[model samples]
Target: MTIKAGDALPQTTFMIPGDSGPEPRTAEALFKGRTVALFSVPGAFTPTCSARHLPGFIEQAGALKAAGVDLIACTAVNDAFVMGAWSRAAGAEGITMLADGNGDFVRALGLEMDGSKFGLGMRGKRFSMLVEDGVVKILNVEEPGAFEVSSADYLLGQL
Candidate 1:
C-alpha cells in the first residue's frame, strides 16, 4: 500500500556516491531529526524527469529550505553512478541525490510502477513527501504522466 501522511518512512538502503565511492545509508539515518523534502522520479535523465522534476526541486532548493525543510533530496530507481552524473549535469548541488538502484525503497513504500511498456522496466511513480523527523507529514502522489501535485512549488505551498 502507498505510504500516506503519518506513516513512518520505511528503512531501506539508498546508495550515494561518496568520496571513497558508493556508500549505503539507511532512510532512518537520513530522515531522523530532520525535516526532509523527499521527492522521487520515475527515472533519472528521462525527458520529464530531466526537463522538469529534478530542475524544479533544484531551482527552488533555497525556497524549500527557507520554508523549514532541513534537507531536500531526490531519489530515482537508477544506480549511484547515473544519479551522481545526473545531479552534476543538472546542477543539483543543492539537493541530495539518492540511488535506489534495486528499486527496494520504492517497493517498500509500495510506490513502484511498471514502466516496462516504455522500455524503462520497473520504476518509481512521481511523488513527493514532507518527512519530519522520520515520519511523513504530507504526501503528494501524482497520476501517470502528471506532475501537478508533486512539484516543488506545490509542496512548498503545503508548508
Candidate 2:
C-alpha cells in the first residue's frame, strides 16, 4: 500500500553525493525534528523531470525554505553520480539530490513502479511528500504519465 499521512517515514539509507564523495543518508536522519519536502521522479534526466518537475523545485527552493521547510530533496532511481550531475545541470544548489540506487527506500514505501517496457527497469513513481519530524503530513502521487499531483506548485499549495 502507498504510504499515507501520519505514517512515519521508512528507515532506509539513500546513497547521495557530497562534496567529498558519495555517502549514505538515512530517512530518519533526514526527517527527524524537521519539516521536509521530498519529491521523487521515475528516472534522472527524463523529459518531464528535467524540463519541469526538478527545475520547478530548484526555482522554488527559497520559497519553500521561507515557508519553514528545513530541507527540500529530490530523489530518483539513478545512482549518486547521475543524480549529482543532474542537480548540477539543473542548478539545484539548494535542493538535496538523493540517489535511491537500489530502490530500497522506494520499495519500502510501496512506491516502486515497473518501467521495463521503457527499458529503464524498476523505478520510483512520481510522488512528493511533506514530512514533519519523521511523520508524513501529506502524500501526493501522480497518475501514470500525468504531472498534476506531484508538481512543486501542487505541493506548495498543500503546504
- Point to the candidate with the largest TM-score: 1
Q: What's the lDDT of the predicted structure labeled candidate 1?
A: 0.93
What is the C-alpha lDDT profile of model 2 across 121-159, one tens digit per residue? 999999998989999899999889999899888888877
Using alpha carbons, what is the TM-score of model 2?
Answer: 0.97
Predicted structure with the largest lDDT when compared to the true one:
1
Off by over 4 Å in 1: none
Structure candidate 2, residue pairs in collision? none
Q: Tell me each candidate's TM-score.
A: 0.98, 0.97
Candidate 1, 97-141: lDDT as tens digits: 889999999999999999999999999999999999999999999
**lDDT score, residue 69, model 1?**
97
RMSD of each: 0.7, 0.8
Question: Which 10 successive residues of model 2 have the least lDDT summed?
Answer: 59-68
